[model samples]
Target chain A: MKHQRWLPWVFLAPTALGMGLFTLIPIVASIVLAFFQWDIITPPKFVGFANFATVATDSTVQVSFLNTIVFVIVAVALQLGISLGLAVLLTEKLPNWLRSFFRSAFFFPLVLSAASVSVFMKYLFNEKFGVVNWLLSLINVPAVPWLTSPAGSAVVIILVYVWQNFGFSFLLFLGGLASIPTETYEAASLDGATGWRKLVQITLPLLSPTTLVASVMAIISALQVFDQPYVLTGGGPGDSTRSAVMVIFETAFQRLEFGQGAALGVILTIIIMLITALQFRLSKRFVFYQ
Target chain B: MTTTLEPRRTASPRTRPAARRRRIDWGMTGRITVLVITAVFVIGPVLWTLSTSLRLPSEAFSLPPSFLPLHPDFTSYAQVFQQLNMALLVLNSALVTGIVALGQMGTAALAGYAFAQLEFKGKKALFSVILATMMVPLQVTIVPVFLLIRGMGLSDTLLALILPALPTAFGTFLMRQYFLGLPPDLAEAAAIDGATPWRTFRSVYAPLAMPGLAIVGILAFNYHWNEFFRPLILTISEQNFTLPLGLVSLQGNMGTGSISVVLAGVILSMIPAFIVFIFGQRTLRTGLTSGLGK
Candidate 1:
């Protein structure tokens, strides 16, 4: 095509404008907003480091931070373990129809909206007449308070979050497994390596890159969890399930503390960036990319 | 080592087929057992949701918790529509998702085409800037974005939700990768035939990029359709509520008393996503793997 210098600019204009106005400007604005006190109606006044000071000593922030850490560790660990296990099973030599069936079934939850899943799980874990308690009652077991109690509610949130999200990692692992050349497995088998030995020697080592990606993604999503706990527990009976994002949302929208909320957002972004950067740095020794 | 060697020692090449068949049978049996267990874990709750949605309120909350409702009732679905005003929320969600999907595809394609084919000053720098923004999660920028939307007087409106989401760095990157893989000779031939850059893009390149368009479209649709955080932050009134917000509020309002109705609403909200997934299964699979695998 006849190269026109203006044409590329024309094509790029809408995206640039959109990103500039919404993404780029807001990013800078968020940093600035973290230092200002503003309600929607009133003009923003710069408050310097006051918001950060409050965040440092706030008890709610402390609880939320601890809860978020617990959630990130437990949720990411379980999700990676289960999804990798599922991916390994699905990738085994199986009938074509069965493979597709398992893939679709496992991935089906990813298509459901988080809100829908949350609602479904909320009712499923309801204290009185929930299916879970009812099922427990079938075996002469007493009904457990799934959502009312703090520890139980936290576990429910973790399980539901894992249920809704693990499929993404499963699919990623499946893709990684599919990409491993069969010749490597065949060669290993010829060397009298089979079953668990072959898997530990060849599969785990080769799948390290995929594992790293999936783990990073799992951690990121786990740390950002909001929808499930927001809907299911609303930070619960005692703030046991309150995630950092939940606190941020409630602070900004519910309480109209935009400055503090922005401060929290900034803090969260820095924490996530550091964690992600640390993962990438540490991955250099473990993640093989051949 | 002994464990690995034992299986191999059991059969030589002459007897391998028979022994392998026996092992295969055992493996299949074990595999089926594991598959059933996993399938139950994955699909059981989903089936429970459907059953609860269809059951009478009394049956839905019965102590024993029957898997199948004896007298299935569609009244909860009716209640969701009547009491919750689900139809309007569905309409709002559809409009927002549709606009965002089409807008994202259009912008991504144009930007991707430029990045892939056209040379411009600071192309590399600009592309890198866009790519870097992908790392900034929406939660970080949401506060300022909300303020910006309010400042523009777009709050409580679908525009607030639609405008910010129209341009996506990931979509642009996906399209650029796809376009870069296209044969360059087609565009060259169009150029030799006196086609302008715009004309070449419109006729020669656009048609070839339909797969990329579909991938972006499906992804954008799924995202905006299910998006809760943005709508929750932006929209104020019940009239402007998307399906997720509506369902959530319905859960709160109904409490535990109207569980069937809430389940019905949940099931209703999932129908569109299920339809999209079924129809675009192949495209979505490829899109996810290719987008994230690298």
Candidate 2:
């Protein structure tokens, strides 16, 4: 029963070592690397602010930046809207088996890797032989160039991203819906609030905490999207679907430009940090904790 | 959870008026219709993938793409295994995922126990640091992490992929939250019985934390299994590739002509996750809700 002073440290040592080596140190190293040029072979040369200057002027970086912003906005909006709708519907009075089945079915895609989904969707959206175009053609519609055109590929990426991710938000929303006490609904009904009015006045305000969490999660994942776009379009169709992470990957690994890549990473980190901070600050009026 | 709501309806049948009951029926019908449509929309692509994976090569791109293959073939599965060397890639992915899962579970449990039970200097500050790391996206640190791995001569090796991910901030946070919710009297009784801290943790807390452990393990497995970017960056040769990387390579080499084979590879890659999901659906759902809902 003696309190061993070092026992806690012993317990913490492994995680501390692993996290420090992998996450903490690397983070600091990334910030430092943004100022230096290195190709993994030569000694890094210090070039303060030069990499940042390049990122500011780089057209591909600009395109990727714009694409990432647009992708996050559209994807988050669609995902939240659809997932919340599904959650509300699924939580209604239905056969137990049907409810469970629908829940599992909707969540099935979350278990699959984004890479697999991307590949399957790439084939699904194939310009010539894809099932999507085929289905469109069945209705006397002309074949659409899904992955071949810039705007088209962008749309595909957003849709694919939403498909792969909405399940997560759906699950969270279900949890939120379940936690709402039945008395609240009864109270709202007594007050003559039902349907759209009930959802907007009572359910939504009470569910704001869940909404806040889901929105934050959706935004973060959407902004960091790499796998779907990478595997599906390879950042192609003239770099339409290229995300910030994809650009960083190509810049560092393909072009062997570590400094610029590090710079881009820093810029991305700052942008995400700022956005998350702003969300938290702005959420004060909307998020209801009780 | 859904079962709890069922009784509310049964209890209301006698008290509810006829008009209310009829309205409820209409609502049920609308809900079922919407649920069916959403289910189809969500699961349609997966079914399509299954169909394409089984279809014969010639029938894969037939003018009217068959909803179901007329003559199903398992040959593409064979092709993926034989021609693309998927077995090795699967084994590699399994190895990495297994190690990372075990590593994360063990480390997270130990750290979580300490943070939840023991009083240590700088514990609060240290825990906050871990939480902060969760907000720092992996993309932000990829350059340095990549260089660090290369410097350690782990590039192109499974170790490169496994080592960096072993200590997960989210996993530790989850385990800690679970431990915090556990009653403290059990640990206190163990201490009064003259059990050492390690024994108390091993014999008492660890067993009770199985649900938390399972959640962490399933999540870690799913993440490392589906991971694409790290393996793509770390490994250069086909021999070191994981499933995602291998599937990409298969697509590149096979092109559109081998669409069936590629779909087979995709289907094969999805099976393990599907199996895990089928068995662990409850645990996965509980884990997700608990982690985020709190």
Candidate 3:
């Protein structure tokens, strides 16, 4: 009995220890660290509500917070809409061989590293002789600074985020669509519904749960946009393209304000948690699981 | 009323057949339109890059761009090997991803076995803790993890990259779910046969749960192979850089755009993932679809 009792722990000990040290401790410490000021060389000093107050009032924080909102709204909304549309189209009674081919092609980018994608995207949008610009110029629209200007760069970032992530949501929606019984569609067809009318009435209502899950994920990911903007624009043309996480990175690493960065981290965490919980709550009304 | 009467009186047989054919043609056209649009949007940039990589600087910048490379060039691929040591980076990424996959699969399988089968105290609590940890983004702990690795003198070492990732909560969670689907009688039979728990896992449970293990392995492999941030922050020396970091380095080091080199680097970073997708397509697709829990 004694030997048997130790076996589970033996299996679990390493994982538990690592998670405790890396995950649990840091999560707790991140919240606690938000209340203190530390610069690595000096010992941390707790200043109860002072850091949070300062973060609330900081102009940089406000800008990033607003930027994050815009990013999440556009990125998440479009990602869900387009992916769901694609998923429906792909789930049609196509030949299995072609289905597999289309699935692989759609999912190709999902497997690539974000850094690689960012690099490629940068070149794709390059102004002077890049592909997108060249294509635009063919229609007489002239060049648009993709990563150089502020507004144009923001649009580019959103476009990249959508392109990279829609595959994931598309796959999820495909799975969900596949699970829907053929009887529902047959019944709809019998009612003389087809095309956009059927899509709006039948498909949209049935795919709500998948949409919720995909949207929540998209929102969380969009809010935490770091790698794309970081590598593609370096959050550049001045902090114009900087995201909320970019601000956190700069605060912690560049300025060495560890405590302030942790504060931003906590704020972001709270915001994400609240938003995600709200999504679940709201999904109760719209997301029909069955 | 007069127009309706005229049509009813003089309905043309040719017009009726043509109208029916047009209806059929419209559906086909709609499907074709959607497919063409998707193909253009998804495959266009990739094809453009491949062509761009094969062109000279003059050819690359030329107006009314040549769709195909007039004179194909392999210089960029050569440069990646000769100048950037991309082959070494590929080896590094492959080694790290492989080790991480093995460790992750082995650990998740064992841990998942304990969670699923063992009637241990704190089982539910421990599993909950793991689930909750999934919500905590890695961005919060990255600095501390870096500091931890640095303190251990493992920074810039492959160990720095591999060890921290061994206990993947998602993988463990996935395995637990997979194990739950297996028949419990196998474990019970093994126990009745005087097999130790370890023996039971190795012989019965592991084989029964091979599909799940493969799924976990693919996910872990893809993640680590494509992992960028940790390697970037942890490894200071260029020699220790993974493929993604090497690609970033190549991007930063380029002068006058160096389009071909960048494309070559992009292609280099893509090969492992592309190969994984090709070889493990079924497992990867099913695993990701299931793991995402839609």
Docking class of 1: medium
Which scores higher on TM-score, 2 or 3?
A: 2
RMSD of 3: 3.8
TM-scores vs. true structure, each candidate:
0.96, 0.95, 0.93
User: Is candidate 1 or 3 superior in TM-score?
Assistant: 1
Better of 2 and 3 by DockQ: 2
Clashing pairs in 3: none
Residue-level lDDT of model 3, residues B113-187, one tens digit each, is: 888877788899999999888887767776567667777889889888988888889888988998888888887
Tens digit per residue, CA lDDT, model 1, A56-123: 78988889988999999999999999889888887888899999998898888888888779899988
Off by over 4 Å in 2: B1-19
Error of 1 at B8 (Å): 14
The candidates, ranked best first by TM-score, are 1, 2, 3
lDDT of 1 at A288: 85
Q: lDDT for each of the candidates? A: 0.88, 0.89, 0.81
Candidate 1 chain A weakest ten by summed lDDT: A1-10
* lDDT, residue A91, model 2: 81
* lDDT score of residue B192 within candidate 2: 90
User: Which one wins by TM-score: 1 or 2?
Assistant: 1
